[model samples]
Target chain A: MMRRYLVGLILIGLAFALFPLLRQAGVAEAPGPLASAYLENSADDFGAANVVTAIVVSYRGFDTLGEVAVLFAATAGVGTLLTRRRLGKAVPPPGRQGGTEVLETASRLLAGLLIMFGAYIFIHGHLTPGGGFQGGVVVAVALLLGLLAKPDAQVSHRVMTTLESLSGAVYVGLGLLGIVLAGGFLDPRALPLGVVGQLFSAGSIPLIYSMIGLKVGAELSGIIDALKGDRS
Target chain B: MMLEIAIIVAGVLMVGIAIATILTRSLLVSVIMSGGVSLLASLVFLLMGAPDVAMTEAVIGSGLTTVVFLYALSRAKQPDDEDAAALASPPGDDTDGGQP
Candidate 1:
C-alpha cells in the first residue's frame, strides 16, 4: 500500500540517479588490457580457438576446480537435507502415470541424442561456444526428461557416484600431471598442443573439460536421485 | 538496431515478470514466473554476447530450479493434504496407531 508505493518511488529515484552516472562511463568498444593480452596470445599459449575456453580451462583451471567442488558440496548438502528413511510402499501420486505415451516415446527417442550432443559440446569446448558446465547441464536435462517420462525409473546411484568420484580424481591427477610435466598445476601445455582450431588442439583443455562435464553431470544426476528419494 | 530493440523488450518484460512474481499469491505461479524471468535474463545475456553465462542461466536457473521448486512444492503440499485427511477421520482411529 503506502509503504510499497514509497519503496517503489525510492527505487525509481535511485535508478534515475544512477542512469546518468552509468551513461557517463562510456561503453567498452574494445577489449580491456587483460582481455587484449589473452586474445593476442590465447592461440599460442593454449592452442584454443575459443579464448574463453582457454582462459577458463587453462589459465583459471584452479578456480574452475574450486567451482566444481562448490557444486559438489551443494549437491551433498541437498542430499543430506532431503534424506529420509523409507517407511512404507512408495506410491506414485495420483494422476501422474509416467506422463503421456508420446512424452515417454519422445524422451526415450531423444535421450541418447541429447547425451551425444552434450558430449560433443564439452569435447569441442576449446573450439566452440559451449564447455563443461553448459554441456553438463544439457546432459542433466536429458536425464531429467527420462525421469519425467518414467516416474518410477531410477538412475543407478552407485554408478553415478562412482563416475563423479572418478572424474574428480582424474581432474586432480591431470592438474598434478601438469605440475610434473609443464610449468605448474593445471597447465594445459603439459601435453603437446595440436593444430589450432581442431578438436584435439588445446593441449589438456579438452580433457579437463571432459572430466568436468562428466563430474558435473554425475553430481547433478545424484542430486536428482536424492530429490526423487529411494522408493525401494 | 533490431537486436538492441529486442534486448530492450526482453529487459522490460523481465522487469514486469519480476513484479508479477513478487505480487502473485500462488507459490507455484511465482516459481514458474521466476523461471520466466531467468529465461528472459538469459536472452538478455545472449544479446550481450555471453553465450556461456546465457546457457547456464537457461539450463540451471530456468530448467533445474523450476524442477526442484516443483518437487519441493509437491513435498510441502503432501503433509497438509495428509493432515486434512487425518483431521477428517474420527479420533477413535488412534487406538491402532500404537502398533508403529
Candidate 2:
C-alpha cells in the first residue's frame, strides 16, 4: 500500500511539474483568434453578462444542444435500469413508500423558490452572469429536492418529455432560421438588435439561451424523477 | 507563478486523497476521497484557463457523481464473513450453514 501510494504521488507530482513547462511552451507570440475574440467580442456582440454563456449559446450552440440530448438519454437509461423489471421477482422493500407532511411542506417551499430563481436567471441571462444551463440546472435541483422530500409526489413524465422535446425543437428551429435568413447558424444579428444593454438586446442569443434553460431544466428533472420514482 | 503554486498544492492534495482512498477499507471514505480527486482536477482546470471545463468538472464530476455513487452504495448489501461455507457449497445448493 505504501509503495502504491508513493508511486501515485510521484506520478501526480511529475504531472504537476510538467504543466508549467507545457504552458510556457504553448505561449505563442501572436494571440489565437479564440482567445482574442473571447476577450474582445464576447460581451459586446452577444449581449450576455457572462462570456461563458455567450460561448455556449453562439460559439458552440450545436454542442450545447448535443449536451442536452446526452442528458436526456442518460435520464432515460437510468430510468430503464432502476425499474421493477431489473430488480426481479422479490418482496418489495419496506418503508420506501408514503409521504410526510413536513417533507412535503419543505419541498413545496424550496421548489417554488428554486423555480422562481431559475426563471429569473433564464430571463436575465443576457444581462447577468447566469444563463440557460446554470438556470436549468437550478431548476433540476429543485425537482430533485421534490423527489427526495416528497415520496408521493410524481413528476408528470409526459409533461417533462413534451417540454424538453419542444424546447429543443424550438432552439433548432431558431438556429435554422438564422442559417436561412442570415449567413450563419446562430447569428445574433439575424434578429433585430433591440437595444445594446437592454433585456431584449442580442437577437438570437437570449432566445437560444432561454430554450436551453428550459430544455436543461426539464431533462434534469426527468432524470431525477426517473431515478427516484420507482419505489414511490 | 501564483497559479503554478495553486496547481502544485491541488495536485499534492489530490494524490494524498487518492492514496488514502485506496488504502482505506471503508467504502464511504473511498467515495469522499474520490470526490477530493475530482475537486482537485476542477481546480487544476480553472488554473489552466479553461473555466468552462472547470465548471463542468466541479458540477457534474464532484457534485452529481458523488451523490450517485453514495446512493448506489446505500442500496447495496454489506458483505460479512460467511466466506468458506458459502464458497464450498455446491453450485446448485441453496443453503448456507449460517443462522439468519
Top of the candidates by lDDT? 1
Number of the top DockQ candidate: 1
lDDT of 2 by residue, B13-82 (tens): 9988999977877777778789889989999998977665675677667766676675554443322232
DockQ for each of the predicted structures, in order?
A: 0.29, 0.13
Docking quality band of candidate 2, CAPRI definitions: incorrect
Candidate 1, residue B25: the lDDT equals 68
Pairs in clash, predicted candidate 2: none
Q: What's the residue-level lDDT of B32 in candidate 1? A: 91
TM-score of 1: 0.85
Per residue, candidate 2 scores C-alpha lDDT tens digits across A99-142 of 67877897889899999988888777777666787678778778
lDDT of 1 by residue, A99-162 (tens): 7889889998899899999999899899988899889988887888898788888787788889
* Clashing residue pairs, backbone N/CA/C < 3 A, model 1: none
Candidate 2: which stretches are off by over 4 Å?
A: A1-31, A88-92, A96-100, A229-232, B1-8, B39-58, B75-100
lDDT against the true structure, per candidate, is 0.84, 0.73
